[model samples]
Target: MALGGILEVVALFIPWVTFTLGSQTASVTFLDAFSKMTSGMDSFAAMYVRFLAFILIAGTLLSTLPWTLGALRTKRSAYWFSGIRRRELTPPNFWWYRTVFAGRATVMLLFHIAGIIAMFYEDLSKIGLGAYLLLLGGVLVIVGAAIGPKLTAAR
Candidate 1:
């Protein structure tokens, strides 16, 4: 979870730094113009960078749900399995937690959906369907990961 957060923060800064540098060194050289518009700033560039940051942050957070849940299940069940029976027994417990993880994952999915919708509403012309698809796929995977537990529980 901490690693996920760190990665998100790092992703948020990438575009900001790239565009900031690009703007600042606008006249320095071809690369400079490509990197920045002014010595330290560019409103237009900053806006784009901010959008990119949001996408990165959302993507990271949205995907973290299932990753974190799986890690937790593995950690929780690691000690219970034996050499020979490990594979058979471990799967049951791991799957049992899916119901719990599903609820959590659903919340994360909703959050991602809202963010994606907001992005489209904010700038209809600029919104990319690719982003929405990516978010949707991430949500579906998380939700699916949690489905095993529910199915087992029903039985």
Candidate 2:
């Protein structure tokens, strides 16, 4: 989960869409994806893709926070957490928090649907590297969430 969250955040900076016009190629990320949706007067489906992208980012961050915070409390730098103790921060079992992860997975799935819509909706536009990274980030997050419980249990 932690890895997924980190990856997702990093992927935002990558190029998701590439537009080449008049010999100039511009690459865009999630940040630009939202604006792209607003440029045209009748791009409601594009809006859905833009919205889903934000939801994916939010869901991953929220779902991964507990794990990341717990790790922070234990990596020999509990002092860095100021007043929070390791035991107080780390949950013994992560699967108990399945609802949060489930929410993230749901959003990721929605994001996938939105991505498909965007692909067909903007068939002429060239997809960029960032879009691929975003897809990967979503997959990683889901995979990490699934394996997280086993990892904690193994520990």
Candidate 3:
């Protein structure tokens, strides 16, 4: 799950699509694609795309936070939070984490699926590594969240 979240974040900076025009080829990251694609569009369409991008970014970060916090709290040197006491930083149990992760993952997955569908409307661009990574990351988180509790309980 942690890996998935990290991958999703990393995917933003890598190429998501590649465009080939006869003899020339160009690859663009998520931000690059967003800027280039929206630059010439009408306000309504641009706004819609912006909204989806915002949701996708925000959802990925939000969903990843709990797992990160939980991981941090488990470390021996995790007392890096300036003034906050150590006890206050302790995370909830596996079930709580699993539930929160699953819920957020589901929402992120929906937006990601929507984004994938939106990509089909574009012309002459091949989906790139970053997009596939994003999809894989979302799936990993969802699957991890769903089965994590059972696996932990079995041990």
Candidate 4:
């Protein structure tokens, strides 16, 4: 999850949109598109890509924290944060939480799917290196998330 999120974020720096006319070609990255927003130019696609960038970061944090922290505990333990206080935790180890990474990948909660959809719908011809990386990285994340749990349990 951490690696995937990092790659997704890095994808922002690579060329995602391309344009061509005659013998000339130009390309832009997510950051480039995003910066355009405050420069008197804004597009729905850029804003949506910006949102997906944030989701990737947040999702990485959520998934990594539990896995890293859970391993240090002597036994399964969780300290929940909520309004006021809770009398007790349902259990030390929660299975539902384990599904978060998988869910994010499967549904593409990080917004890679949306990015892909938006790209294909808006301008297929303009897709470039970064867009291809985004699609490939997204698929890797999904496959890794799906297999990671099973691999851990088997050993």
Candidate 5:
């Protein structure tokens, strides 16, 4: 469920980023940059880039779903029900917590990598919404990876 929430947030960010980018005036360099972005490139390249982005978005959500469902199973498991807490947690299980957390970590890692890639290839002058996304995503990944386990263990 945690993973799901994180992924859903990222998926939502996509159209938001696209709209922001679309609304902005393209610099002469923006046009020129694309012109020099591999001479043989076609609309197909744009399509492929979009497709890759879509896959990353979908993969984040898809990976998260099973972890969400597993939360329910964790609640029902006998091991989880026996004094795990005074009141049951939403997921109410240790393993489930770890699994969901690890899934979240996985998504964060993926996001971090993607952000680095975008940052590397990006024209600094054109850095805008995408740079913000990358920055935020990188921070989230670092925080999650560094602190998430401690939170889980405390529970």
Candidate 6:
């Protein structure tokens, strides 16, 4: 999951699309393409893309940071909101944690798929490395989320 998050972040800076004219070629990174492409669009579509992008980034960071840190520190997956009340810090319920992670992964994956389809609807071949990386990263996150519970239980 952490690796997937890191990959997704890296992909933002990589070329997502390349345009070639008679003698000139220009490549656009994910960030550039997103901003430029959305600028000329209808308000509704632009808003939706922006919202999805926000969720993708937030979900990746939120899941990755805690999972990476928890694994490194205690070799266990971190539980969200695990003991905010009182002085003692109690571990969260395993089933609840797993459910949350799975649901979050599902949402993220769906958003990624939607974004990919929207961007490449006109020309599938125009899709580039960054887009592929984004898809792979989302898949990895889902795989990690699925296996996280079992790994935690085994430990």
Q: Against the hidden reference, what TM-scores do the models get?
A: 0.37, 0.59, 0.62, 0.62, 0.39, 0.71
lDDT of 5 by residue, 1-155 (tens): 34434543453333222223555844322223333466454544343343444455455445434443443245455234232343344533445454454555476556544643553454444444533553454345434433333224344
Q: After superposition, how far is residue 147 of candidate 5 from its true place, in Å?
A: 9.6
- Against the reference, the lDDT scores of all candidates come to 0.43, 0.57, 0.63, 0.55, 0.42, 0.64
- Give the CA lDDT, 0 to 100, for residue 99 in model 4: 47
Tens-digit per-residue lDDT, 62-132, candidate 1: 54444444433444353332112333325556554454445554665565556445434655554343444
Model 5 worst lDDT window (10 residues):
11-20
Query: Which stretches of model 6 miss by more than 4 angstroms?
Result: 37-40, 43-45, 48-51, 64-96, 149-155
What does candidate 6's lDDT look like per residue over 45-147, in tens digits? 3654556666676766676445434442332323233221222222444445445565677787787777777767888899889878877877777667655
Q: Mind giving the per-residue lDDT tens digits that candidate 4 earns over 1-155?
A: 44665566677799877777789997888778767655443454555655655676466545543443343232324333211132222333234434444566556544655655664686577677776676666666655554443223432
Model 2 per-residue lDDT tens digits across residues 1-155: 66656666776677766777999987777666666565464454565555756665886666555544444435344334222332332455344344445556657656665764556464635656665666666776666655444334554
Ranking by lDDT: 6, 3, 2, 4, 1, 5
Q: How accurate is candidate 5 locally (lDDT)?
A: 0.42
Quote the positional error of residue 47 for candidate 3 in Å: 4.6
Report model 5's TM-score to 2 decimal places. 0.39
Off by over 4 Å in 3: 37-49, 67-100, 122-125, 147-155
Full-model lDDT, candidate 4: 0.55
Model 2 stretches with alpha carbons more than 4 Å out: 36-44, 67-107, 149-155
Model 4: residues with Cα > 4 Å off, grouped in runs: 1-3, 38-46, 64-98, 149-155
Better of 1 and 3 by TM-score: 3
> What lDDT score is found at residue 101 in candidate 2?
51
CA lDDT for candidate 2: 0.57
In model 6, which range of ten residues has the least summed lDDT?
81-90
